[model samples]
Target: MPELRTERLLLRAWQPADLAPWAAMNADPEVRRYFPEVLTREQSEASVARFQADLDERGWGWWAVEVRATGEFIGFTGLDPVDEDMPFTGVEAGWRLTRSAWGHGYATEAARAALTFGFTTLGLPEIVAVTTATNLRSQAVMRRLGMACDPADDFDDPDVPDGPLRRCVVYRISAGTALS
Candidate 1:
């Protein structure tokens, strides 16, 4: 797996040391607020295992992000293949960070590196981002990454239960677009 570096972060493959913190982050109510539920330690570990396996097989997936200065495991930010059942199927840029990492623009910074890898290294034509309409925090990061939104692209996420979170907005950026 490739390791991505930014001014203050290292987006790399998962390490054994990351398991405990990763689970704790998943269990954080604030961190998992946009999701349907907070994950149990077992569920979080399963997710970590899945992400690690995907990275091993594909050479790219959600990466474990660490703060370079302090060597703290913050969270993950990277690309994922959108599910086939969605109205649009393609690679999506996504991120999740602990509350302590929230206000420092780390998500945008790490995600920019991920987008570069997606467009240049992976030769992807375009990448999309999706979030619940109410997830303004994530949407702001998407815009900061130079992704444009199209209201027509909005759709109800079938995988989410019928609720506010099911109504999702989609944003996209082409491979060569200038990122802010």
Candidate 2:
């Protein structure tokens, strides 16, 4: 995927040098709350490889979110495919950032750019975003992006391990809407 430049962020593919900070963010408990487990360094490397491969195949995925001014990798926010059966069969918008990047509106900014790519570049009719019930922060970002929570679309994530956090709330945003 080609790099996407926002006013303050550079959304692009991951690099080998992003491993340390990326792994650190994945391993952080605060940031990993919605994830089943903290990812190890090896897991993080493998995940980055998968992200790159997905981008190669589909032209987009959870892109590497970076600070344009300092050239620092913060985290990622972009579009990805969901394996679950749902209202839409296309891609979904999503984002994740390190603790330091929280409360900075990076998620909304990067995600809006991703939505533009999904609707304009990929020609997707709509995009979806799912989060655990406790993930109000991400949900708020979704709302700010003009995505509406579809209570009827809520379901337990088939991909989530059998546990307490399996239930999720799904949000939907159609293309050509007033999103952003």
Candidate 3:
């Protein structure tokens, strides 16, 4: 799989060393605030397995993100086919970071790299980002990556239980408007 590098972060394939910190991040309440619930170690490991398989197959998918400076595993950011169960279909850009990594523009930086790969490398015509309506931090990062929100594209995710995370918002960026 192709490894992506930004000024301060690396978007690379998963390593055995990443498992511990990845589980810790998934178990973190703050880190999982937008999701249905925190994940168990088994769930986290299974997710890594799935992500790695996709990467191996297509050469691109969710990547383990790390700080290039200290080699600290921060989180993940990359492109994935929108879940088959979703109301929509297209590639989506996403990122998750450890709580300590927030407010540092790393999400935007890493996401921008993902978006670039989607638009240029994969020749995708558009990429969308979906998040809970309440996840303003991720929305902000989407906006920074030049993605625009259209209320018409928003929908309540059928998979999420009726709650704070059910209402979803989607931000979109077409290849034409993508920023390098």
Candidate 4:
């Protein structure tokens, strides 16, 4: 898989060493707050395996994000195919970081790299991001990346069981609208 470098983070292929930390990130209630539930270690490991497979086959997917200077596995940031069951169809940009990695602009920086790749190298016309409507943290990151939300795009996620998280907002940025 191709590796992406920013000012500090490296978006690269998942390594065996990243597994434990990735699992921890998945299991953290705070980190998983926007999702339905925290993941088990086995589920986390399976996610890494799937991420690696996507990277190996497509040359891009959710990447293990590491701090360049310290080589610490903080989390993941990259492009993913929007869930097939969603009302929309397109690539999506996403990020998840360890609590320690929050508030450092890492998500924005790393996600910018991912969006750049989707718009330029992959030639995708547009990329979208979805999060629970109440997930202001991620919504803020989307805004930082110059993505805009159309109220009309909001919808109840078909895949989510009944809960607060079912209502989601979709933020979109076309190639022409993406930041340089």
Candidate 5:
């Protein structure tokens, strides 16, 4: 996909040279706290490769986010389809950033752009966001984006081991009301 530029970030595809920084971000315990595990260098490279391929084939994937002024990559954000049997079938918006980029409204900005792409360019009616129950920061971002929590729509994430974090919370926003 083409690069998306925000006031402070450039969201674009990953390059091979991004492996080291991507791996370092993955290795940061704080950054990986919500994920099951920190990805190794090889895994990071593979992930980036897959993301690149997905963008090439589908025209949408998690694009790398970089600082606009310095061109320093910070992390990624994009739209992803939830697996089959998910409560919602449409695309879902998501994001992740390095510790250095946290609390700067970058996640909200990048995610808004992704959601716009999903609802406008992709013509999706609604987009959902799922995260561990304990991931309050992400949940808060969803709310800030005008998504509503559907307590009745909670689900157990088979990908995550059974635990508090495994019981996922879902947030949703329709294209008509995303900016409300």
Candidate 6:
């Protein structure tokens, strides 16, 4: 896949070295707070393997994000095709970063680049972002990306048990929309 450069980050394919930090991040309570559950090292590796396979086959999926200046593998931000069983199905923009990387604008910066690639490079008509109703941080990033929310689009995630995480909200942005 192609590498995307933002002001301070590089969105690129996953490397062998990213596994350790990626696993550590997935295991972090703060980082995984919004997720349904913390991922084990084995599960994290499996996730990486799945992402790598997707990128290898489709040339695009969740790309590993690195700091340009320090070359640190902070996290990942990219697009993924929503599962067919989901309430809404389409390309979704998502991000997950290490705890230390929080409070920085990395997620928004890298996500914008992914959205750009999705619209311009892939010619996708629209992209959606889904998060638990309580995940205000991610919802803020979606707003910054010019995604609009419609309460009617909200749905309970079938994969999540009936609880706070199950009540998810979706934000969407169409092609040609101006991004913040």
Candidate 4 lDDT over residue span 1-180, tens digit each: 689999898999999999999999999999999999999999999999999999999999999999999999999999999888889999999999999999999999999999999988999999999899999999999999999999999999988998899999999999998845
State candidate 2's TM-score.
Answer: 0.93
Across residues 30-67, which tens digit of lDDT does each residue of candidate 5 receive? 99888788888888888898889889989898899888
> Whole-model Cα lDDT per candidate?
0.94, 0.87, 0.94, 0.95, 0.87, 0.93
| Residue 50 in candidate 3, Cα distance off native in Å | 0.5
Model 5 lDDT-worst window of ten:
83-92
Off by over 4 Å in 5: 85-87
- The candidate maximizing lDDT is 4
Give the Cα error of residue 132 in candidate 1, in Å.
Answer: 0.3
Candidate 4: pairs in clash: none
lDDT of each residue in 55-142, candidate 2, tens digit only: 8887788899999999999998888887656534667788889999999899999998999888888888888898898889999999
- List TM-scores for all candidates, in order: 0.97, 0.93, 0.98, 0.98, 0.95, 0.97
The lDDT of model 2 is 0.87
- Candidate 6 per-residue C-alpha lDDT over 1-180 given as tens digits, one digit per residue, 9 for 90 to 100: 688999999999899999999999998988999878999999999999999999989999999999999999999999999999898889999999998898899999999999999998999999999999999999999998999999999998888888778899999999978433
CA shift of 59, model 6, Å: 0.9
- Counting clashing residue pairs in each candidate, in order, gives 0, 0, 0, 0, 0, 0
**What shift in Å separates residue 119 of candidate 4 from its native position after superposition?**
0.9
Model 1 global lDDT (CA atoms, 0 to 1): 0.94
Q: After superposition, how far is residue 16 of candidate 1 from its true place, in Å?
A: 1.3
